[model samples]
Target: MTKQYSLKHIRNFSIIAHIDHGKSTIADRLLELTKTVAERDMQEQLLDDMDLERERGITIKAHPVTMAYEAKDGQTYQINFIDTPGHVDFSYEVSRSLSACEGALLVVDAAQGVQAQTLANVHLAIDRDLEIVPVLNKIDLPAADPESVRQQIEEVVGIDASGAIACSAKTGVGIADILERIVTNMPPPKEPEDDLLRALIFDSHYDNYQGVMVYVRVMSGEVRKGSLIKMMATNKNYEVQEVGIFTPSEKPTDSLKPGEVGYLIANIKNTQDIKIGDTVTSQKNPAPLPLPGFKHISPVVFAGIYPVDSSDFEALRDALAKLQLNDSALHIEQESSMALGFGYRCGFLGLLHLEIVFERLQREFDLDIISTAPSVVYKCLINDGQVVDIDSPAHYPDPSTIESIEEPWVVCHVMIPSEFLGTIMNLCMDKRGSLEKTDTLSMDRLLLTYKLPLNEIITDFNDKLKSMTRGYGSFDYEFDNYRESDIIKLEIKVNDEPVDAFSCLVHRSKAEAKGRSICAKLKEVIPRQLFKIPIQAAIGGKIIGRETINALSKNVTAKCYGGDISRKRKLWEKQKKGKKRMKEIGKVSIPQNAFMEVLKTD
Candidate 1:
């Protein structure tokens, strides 16, 4: 069913910025100004619908909404606004969101200027060929200096940022100016003949009632209700049951056309059916050019996720599957442990993504989870020409494997005030991070780059860095391949038994410090289940340090008022039963908190 529609009245764009740069707040103001969402209906960061995102005040996923605004020239245009996640962990999602836009609103905090993630996202936007409209956000703040921010943008990004709009998304100052620039500076959607129906799936989520709802940007034709569409990537076809537009509020529309962004409801049931960047075209006459798709995002960090109640494994799986539908970047698999029962091995882009997923799993689904310390994938070679990926501690090759092992390295960029440079540098060096270069971004700010092992960064490196800089520093890293290094495996043993799950790899020079810290933290967290538990970090059977949890004592004091002699005997029997129920205090194994102890680097 093909429908004809008028063209050239639509503009699609996305907002990109580092975390806490007022991206979501700016989007809210835009929605309010366009009258897409009512003034009274506005909530802080309305697009951040996830409970975890709301609580954390960070956008974890990209959300799309359509708004209509009449320009000062009396021309009305429909603007499809996409709000993207600012964290580096969601960089792939951000990139996909940008693909649907012709331009992006690059928001930078006037006071914070361009941080590490800001530079990373700006380069991504440039790579996608999206026109950038720089906006100096938070200008109303006392620390804001729009001129200095503009100079930083020009110097770092090489853009003529002289006329960048200075706006306070919180106060609505210069907001209209920002919107006007979006309309005038952003090019209208490209007009292509409706020869064949072609739409690009930038994002999708699963709905229990509607099945899979796909968010797509139509590139070359009309997609209407009951049309048969094929996902080019998977060669899967589905009949569109519904076509609609999102106002941040869903509204059913008869059809969607070229350059318009909207959603399609089909019988598609699985996320694998509609992958991000897959092209949807008419099964009868598909488009000739395949849509340009980015590489599949690979998770660089891995962690163990266990349900608080071992019986909740099924519930956890269901929750994770549902989350994965919207977040294609999240990966999970099932595994069993003698201690933790059934749990999952989850893959995440980085530490931030890992944290967000766990938070959402608990907050949204009400599934309490115990997440183990995060680890990065390591590549190792054995003496017999064998190579293996060590994602979990259990998979780590034995120390006697007799061949070299390489850990992933990253190029990290840290931006901090000049005063804390010495402290921050010392911390990085202690973590086996080598300073590669340092440059002054401003008279009082410095940008330092370090080549650090990915394993080190995956642990408490982030927390330590923030603490060292007094929370005034921002950092981002990208994998810079692997490097050969002198690495030592630190094994944790309990009761003379090696626990592979509690093992970690560290630089030989820092093994003693790292081991002692890990053991101490473990002692504080791992409770005495039934018996006292010994936490010892060892290298080649030689213990570096050890901590022991005292065995828990059980006390039973019950009344026996019955006059019957047999009743008194029964009471004594009941006391014995109670003692038996007290999980054999000396042999109870590990506690739930032990899994979380190693998560904190500091």
Candidate 2:
């Protein structure tokens, strides 16, 4: 028989940590100790069901599972684990996860110490006023220094770690102690009245058999099977077909009571009807007021997603529609590229999110897609006192109509070793980062804060940081505001015809070098034709950089070997004239792969 817990016995908490800090591994061990999954069914990262998630060793979606455990106090308590993505790109989802829980398991790596994401999540948990229980993971490793990490957490994170549980999720050692700490240290949900239905949709995903399945945390009343429920945000109603909890898998339940986390499936056909963070209530006895919802998150990075073959345009759109049902952060619109054909201009939280979405489109849907260079939305103020937001390069307005442009800026925090301070500062400066402040966290560690352009950090910033710091440096960033800058639209022309795929907004100072680099790369990718093709990078009417792809050489004199010298000269003259005429009229056809390669350059 399934065990039941009262409101006081239910502990809703989430695991928050840095990427690759064993959050998933710890979740697996928790399931084992609680016996939520049978020993025969045990596997690594059991909750990460997606193949791409396991292969990448990262959590792309937020998952909540309930487990019944008998603590050292001889009391059976129900625990709901909200597993979240560790990367900064999904911090908004992490925030949503926190709001659904009463406490958090602040997992830290014993060897890696406190990272940028660790600090960022800790602050978020604190802001939510959730009780935090610090846990030191990977204690079985040879390099594990639990005591050192504990002290660093105390100093940097401003949390008392003297009672932090030290254990290795890999070996399952000290697993029992961690569970005990969760029940003893973390506060349980308050007693909820069984009056009106007030459930929050924390996360959701689409089910082929069940349609849209919403993962909700019941705040009050109950959601029972065969009951009418209404989404307070969308004002859409549905007949609840079933309600269930995740024992790492969706197990059907009769009803989800107050202060419990579980799934609710209705006959809802449209994915647009369900909104994340919206409140779900019983239509019969609706709650007086809906729960506070989260702020609408906007995309930080914009890119054009075009199918390799134009025939798959509809398939790509359908795939994105299904994917967006699970990922609320993705934003998309219809876009047409001159070289790439019909496609969508998509916006993502960050570069990783963008890559993950594309990977899913290819692996899950089996569609070939080409993504243009990732760009940020620029706020353009025209000379006629009009403001416009440009998300795609193709939509960039004429430069003659613009007066000024404002680009998004971010406040970044970098935690690094003191010795590499000089190297990192110079690297940040090269990326247009301005140092705001610096602090000595410890004898060996330093924290540096900078105000940088969001565009600068979205592309390969973290990878470059790891490269310079030998993989020891960590950083987190948040949007600060938009700042006016000297920005210009960069357009690439092949044979005097503009290619929309090779257009972007760049700062005026770096336009020359960037244009030169782009033109040089085009010269390499664009195939040699019957005539020399001139590639030019132009801003407005002024050409900043240019390159020429030499035409294919022909042996015009080969057929005149036995003829006189005049015959050979005439053949050469005819070839030159023909080449000149072809150069004037020949249209450069950029292959799909060539457009993909050119965008990847620089």
Candidate 3:
């Protein structure tokens, strides 16, 4: 029989660190050390279940698993480990995971030392007042220096690392010491008052066979199968069909009490009914107040996602619906474009989130997609004194509307080696980033703070920073505020008609260069027709840049037998007339790949 432990013996914690800092590997080691999974069935990155996540070597989602560990003090304890994604795109998910836990394992690489994301996650954990256990990973590597990293963590992260655990998840060294620290150092879940049931839903997903599966950290209640549960945020009730805990896989349990982490299935057909950070309680005896931090999340980045083949529109919609069941960060709305036809404009937290959603659609749903250039929400003040929020170029009003445009700005924190300071500063200035301050951590490392336009960093900022620094730089940012900027609506005209889908908002200084680049790329991608097709980038009625696709010459007299010289004229006139007719009626079909090329700025 499975050992049942009281709330005081249960320790709920999450693993947080920088990207590629061995969070998943450490979680895998914990699973093995506790014998949660048989050694014969163990695999690398065992907690990263998604193929995309494994292939990319990043944890894209947060996963929770339960393990029974015997402490050094000889008490059998139940430990719930919530593995969170380290990317800034999924930081909201990480916040939810941290809110559900009482402690966190702060993993840092022995060689790489502290990174940007490490500090970001550390601030989040500290905000939640969670007990932090510092761990230095990858001690088996030749460049590993645990003592130096411990000092860095203490000085930079402002955490006491004297008792930090050093371990190599790859070689299974010091695994037992880490487990013993978890058992003895990390505090257990705090006891709740004797009140009605209330469980916090940190994560949820739609299961095809079982309906809505909600992952809950029971706070003050016990729930079981057939219990009538209500979501406080939505105020909707459902009969609990099943309840279980993840032993890597869902295992049914009789009931989940306080301090336990598990999944509960409620017969919910609509995925919109359950949201992350919601409070689940008993209908018969509800709590007086709902749990804190239950609020709707809003998306910052927006893009239009269209199926390459218009016939797959419904298929794409269905796929998005299913994906949204698990990722509530994605927001979608129905939209149409004259050039791209029908599609949904989707919003995300960041560029990484957008890329992951696109990959999932292609890989999991077998859908070929064309995504437009990502945009940030812009606040426009119109002549009528009404403020309009615009996320797509299709919705941009005419310039004659006499309005000012405001774009979102972010406070970016970049940590890099001090040697590349000049190069990074120059690059940031080119992107319109204004330096606010700089902090010197040591002789070799520095942290740069800048206020940058959100539009500047959405595309290839991170990639370029890595390229310039030789992959030693890391960054994190948060939305600061919207500021007024001199911006204009840039449009691409094919022949004489403007393509709505290719329109975008650009700053006054970059309007000419951006337009020239787009026109040049369009010239290369758009195929030459019978008549010369001119591609022009225009701001209002003035053309700023232009390119032309030369017409393919035809041998009009190749098939003619000699008669009078007038016969040649007649044939030439006929050919010219035909060409004119074709030019008038012929429409250029922009291939899906061509649209994708136009969106690739870097």
TM-score of each: 0.87, 0.93, 0.93
Residue pairs whose backbone atoms clash in candidate 2: none
Instruction: Please provide, for model 3 over 482-557, each residue's C-alpha lDDT reduced to its tens digit, 9 standing for 90 to 100.
Output: 9999878898999888988788988889899999998899888888888878899999999999999888878878
lDDT of 3: 0.89
Evaluated at residue 210, the lDDT of candidate 1 is 88
Candidate 2 displacement at residue 119 in angstroms = 1.6
Write candidate 2's Cα lDDT for 1-602 as tens digits.
36668777888999888878899999999999899999999988888889988998889887888999888778899999988887788887788788889999999999888888888888889998999999999988899988888989898889899999888899988889878888888888876765788898888888888888998998888888898999988888899999999988899988898889999999777666777778898888888888874566788899889889999999999999989877767888998867788999898998889989999999999999888888898999988998999876666888888898999999899999999999999989888999999977777999898999988887778888999999999899888999999888888899999887888888888789989998998888888999888999999999999999988989988776585799988889999999999888888888766776777775
Best by lDDT: 3
> Higher-TM-score candidate among 1 and 3?
3
Off by over 4 Å in 1: 1-7, 383-386, 400-402, 486-488, 520-535, 540-602
Displacement of residue 375 (Cα, Å) in model 2 is 0.9
The per-prediction CA RMSD against the true structure, in angstroms, equals 7.5, 2.7, 3.0
Candidate 2 segments exceeding 4 Å error: 1-3, 551-577
Candidate 2 yields a Cα-based lDDT of 0.87
Q: What are the lDDT scores of the predictions, listed in order? A: 0.82, 0.87, 0.89
- Clashing residue pairs in candidate 1, if any? 460-601, 530-584, 530-585, 530-586, 530-588, 531-585, 531-586, 531-587
